[model samples]
Target: MEQYDIAVIGAGPAGLFCAIHSIGPGIHVLLLEKNLQPGMKLRISGTGQCNITHDGDIRMFFPRYGAHGQFLRPALMSYTNQMLIRFFEERNLPMEITEGGKVFPVSHKAGDVCEVLIRECQHPGVDLRCGEPVHRVENTPLGFVLYTAGDTFSAKNLVIATGGASYPKTGSTGDGYRLAASLGHTITGIGPALTPLLIRNFPFADLAGMSFAGLPFSVWRENRKIFDGQGDILFTHTGLSGPGILDRSRDIRAGDEIQLSFAGPVQCDTFEREFQNIISRAPTRSIKTIIAGLGIPERLARQLPDLAGIPADSTGAHLTAAGRTILIGHLTACPLVVSSPGDLSVAMVTRGGVALGEVNVKTMESKLVPGLFFSGEVLDIDGDTGGFNLQAAFSTGFLAAQGISKRVGKRT
Candidate 1:
């Protein structure tokens, strides 16, 4: 078996960074990845723009990770989004900041980011292998042992950065969870998150292309309100999706009904004035038809008469004050009965992974499994889109690599 100073498994962001940080004279470092090439997921993130990190104060960044926010606070502050941007820029790969302070490559290519990392990990002290899935990990008296296809390797330190199970097409496929579980590490609950919601709302059908661009919506879980976000939302045949919808997806329960709030970015008083304006202009049209044209879709518009207990064909002149009042209520906060969550393959990230308590934040190392460090979505930490996920991978990977260096030294 080849004995190395450090063996980092899963050539994703965390593993690659660990290898890069471990590089120095006389160090024996090996990086193993199951995918045919490294950064497959990175290549597709941000639609290939590779939203690497968000430019913001470290304080606000913590809440974005939810409960795991605290664990990441120290490492996140240490590496920071500013530093990651510099790390790439120093490699001649400049980045650009966009809406929501999201940072991306200048060419909007995730491939460029991946290319730079691969190049950086190519020093003599570092060795990288892809298309290799780790079969098992054995914790030795000193260091650790890793078994992969056709070979077994030994090292004094190991870092696992296999990413999350979401986006299996990128080769995440839950392999990390399996490998970590085998090492006696507890795998936290995992579920598809940042995915679109499927709905049974008929109006959403007609409003399929209609988007409340950067508008806000409230997501309800049973009778309790769960999550609220302000951003673009699009009506689809399935349900609802877009930046805002994806943001609130994790808190959404199976039986929740997604509804747009009237008390949203557009104020209720303003909506009332706007609604009355339209109702007065087209008394010739059915009150139902008139309201449909007021930012509500035809499919959803068609259902107003039923909600108001007035016939769809009933004229505006025929509608009493009661019918008009009832009609407005339905349009203001239309309800969408949710169906199952979108498939995991299409999801952007996983909501849950390895619990935070089990991993050391300063080192990004797993206390339960010595030498087994984790980063990226494999840990029970996920953030909303707009460059949060990529940042976590970059920051945590850097921290984990730094930890491995201090523990194992720079050489074999």
Candidate 2:
């Protein structure tokens, strides 16, 4: 039986990097990947552009992960965004930051980023085995035994970076959760996070490509407004999508109300007065014509009268008091009842995973099982869109590598 210093499962950003960083003069690391090619998901991130990480001080990353942000503070601090930028840049992979503060390779290709990591893994003493799916993991006095389809391997330290359930086709079929659960780790409420929402009986199905930029949006649960933000929204054939809606999808549930204010800066109190002023100026114009002139998309503006329950051909001068209120309300808060979250198969990331309490934040190691570690989406930490999740994966993987090396170095 061959023994190694570290066995990393999954070849995603976390596991691959963990294996790369853990290599040393005496350290022998084995990387097992279920897929034929590594970084399957990374290749498709940011529509192939690969939003690598956000550019800023480490403090900006705290709130981006929601409640779990503080848990990620130590790992992120150990490997700050600046350090990550320098780490890749020093290796000849020049990166650029966009206006949104997202960092990407100058090549603008996620494949290039994966190529760099894969090329670096060719370093001596590191064994990367592809098309090997870890069927089971057994804990032993020696350390851990990983059973793959091909054969079995043993390692003194094991890192499970198998990722979450989202994008299962890419080999992130929530295997890590099952693997961790088998080893006595608590799996949190697992669901889709950065996924799109499906609206029930969506009204603007025909206006699929219409997008509203800087739209003020709100989510209400049982009449209680729970979330509020401003983002660009895109109308899909099924419902709504885009950065704004995608960001809030984690908080939304079936039967929740998603409101979009196409009226922009106009408030309800002022909307009626402002609308009336426009109507007074163009009393002879049809309601559709008047709305289309307000810079709203002509296709969506044409449907506004029907959405507000007003006569489509009614001119501004023929507007009734009740009709005016309905139109004003509809413009300010177009309500859409959510049917459910987008399918997990298509979700960009998963919401819940192994609970945070069971894992050591500083090292990305399992608190219950010694010598067992986890990183990336396999853990409960899921961040918002815009390169936060990738940054978390890289930072945690780096820390886990450091932790394993430090612990094993003392033993050697």
Candidate 3:
């Protein structure tokens, strides 16, 4: 029957960071977790590099959340990239900038960052728990009571830092969603984001183990343009993936066509001109060999002829003028039928959760209930790849903890 000023329902980025914000000399905060360790998912993020944050201006950070990004301005501003970097530096975990402004610890270990956060909870006011599964959250006359199999705890304020439903092995088992909804908060449609795309084409098999750079691709939702970006893309056994494809995976619906403008920044006419003139430089070469050098992956080079309704073996000398134009068009505009996105289990993050409007945007507290706050992937906001998800989790958790600090400290 331990009593505390604040009870946090997770030990991940949101819960732990939130506890850090609120925990001072007098504050008593309990951070709970079901896993044996905190930040198991963080340990594996960015292929184990753990992209800490982006190294860009604020506006560049916003669009990472897609449409819901607008809601994250306050928290992100309150704890910007510079602050995050400084926070790590203060703790002796210096960071460095990777490609696309993505930040990572100079040591390149996600566990090192997690270690600093875990060590931060060593302060007297913070009591962090692991391997504890909280069963229910009940509002008590005093404030809130959280029941776990091991013990029952009461708090003046509750922060649901329980994360999203991606990477179940990482321990985000949609616990926050259930907890928030139980307290009368409305959760939006939840789906996988920043995950890989699943295409049905078998020829895609040939492209497996291939990665491309500087290729542009477009995402569409029933004829309406959703997003487009030029970057590296890779083909896995499951489907198309990489930075450009994962960014689009959030809003992509079922049965959508993933139209790829392989020409990238080069306009269609310019590509067309480049295509026609390219063969002249290698007039004696096979058409497949000539187009293979058109700045695309070698696998795509051989496939373009088949896609253009011309035999791949056909040389530039064998093709008619119409064939040349058709080949150029197919090369510029390669279409991949995106039957579905990669499995949610394999997804990097979740798309939707507790609605932002239902929670106080300023405090991250539940509007329907006092002494209740939510953070991390449980929130409705979703960001694309490149460390935005972790940043969101860290921001909301810290913000909610600040609110709890003010309320609980005054009550005492």
Clashes of each: 4, 0, 0
- Relative to the true structure, candidate 1 reaches a TM of 0.89
Q: Which ten residues in a row are the worst by lDDT in model 3?
A: 257-266
TM-score list, all predictions: 0.89, 0.95, 0.92
Evaluated against the true structure, the overall lDDT of model 1 is 0.79
Model 3, 188-265: lDDT tens per residue?
Answer: 998988888888664567678788786777766677776776777887876788887787788777687776666566
Q: How far in Å is the alpha carbon of 4 misplaced in model 3?
A: 1.4
Better of 2 and 3 by lDDT: 2
Best by lDDT: 2
- lDDT of candidate 3 vs native? 0.83
Give Cα-based local distance difference scores for all models: 0.79, 0.89, 0.83
Quote model 2's TM-score: 0.95
Once fitted onto the true fold, the runs of candidate 1 whose alpha carbons sit more than 4 angstroms away are: 262-317, 409-412
Range of the 10 consecutive residues with the lowest summed lDDT in candidate 1:
261-270
